[model samples]
Target: MQPRKAATADVPELIRLRAVALESLGTNPGPADAPWRRIARHWFDERINRRDDCVCLVVGGGPGEPLLACGMAWITYHLPDSRRPDGRRGYLDGIVTDTPAHGRGHARRIVDELVGWLHGAGIHYIQLHTSEAGKPVYEAAGFVPGRYPGMDLITAPPGP
Candidate 1:
């Protein structure tokens, strides 16, 4: 089935899918009742319902059921470069499917749609960090290892 753009109602299931993804990558998902989950609900509403720069898609499930897979990406801006004179970039936040739905081409379809959305928004440079288990799907979608290395700096302590 074709994936559809996620609505605010899908926010909770999307959070669950993200946690499942983190666990698959061997990262801790933390406690279920963590305060951050409450805040995340608001963030999802803002980003998915009120924003135009983001694209989030979900597949499977029904009117009252949990979702099977979801994917999200958003635009980013950087100092201008030759390839992207406008400096518009696409950051693929993540994609995930419930364990029962793995190996069914869900990730590929979601990635394809998310990429299409980004391209529709005039973004050609897309980037994402994939787990080893997820690398093949991304590669098949035309993603290649970039020449530039990824680095990050911690600007603040974790938690509120």
Candidate 2:
């Protein structure tokens, strides 16, 4: 199936698919959490509609059909580096596929599309953190283990 750039109208489905992805990663809120749903929807809306630096892509059965997979990238600028003289990097986020749609190459296709788009946009560096199940897919797409180690400091925990 062909991957398409997501529209603002696709936010609801994208949010749902994101939950599926997060759940697979063991990081999602309980399914009945209304507040989290509202917050996620709002966040996605702003990113999809208001942000020029974000791009969301999806592959699926088409309009009125369930999306098979979805992926997103956030563009950021940094001081020029040897690999990226322009200092443009694409941070991949929220790449997920419907549970029932796994093993169909949907996630791979969307990632390929995103990488191509990033290249066309003159972005040379791309990065993402993937689950163990997802490691193979990203690896096959030409991503190597990063040279620099990554560390995170969580300043605060989420509320219940």
Residue 132 displacement (Å), model 2: 0.6
Model 2 weakest 10-residue run by lDDT: 28-37
TM-score of 1: 0.93
Q: Residue 90: error of model 1 in Å?
A: 0.6
TM-score of each: 0.93, 0.88
Give the backbone clash total of model 2: 0
Clash pairs for candidate 1: none
Question: Per-residue alpha-carbon lDDT of model 1 for 1-160, expressed as tens digits?
Answer: 7899888888889888878988898888899887767888898889888999998889986798889888899999899989999999998876988999889998899999999999999999999988888889999999999779989997977898
For residues 1-160, could you state the per-residue lDDT of candidate 2 as single tens digits? 8788887778778878877877898885567566878898888888778888888888874668878889998888889888889788998888999999999998899889888878888887899988999999999999999989999987877889
Q: List the residue pairs that clash in candidate 2.
A: none
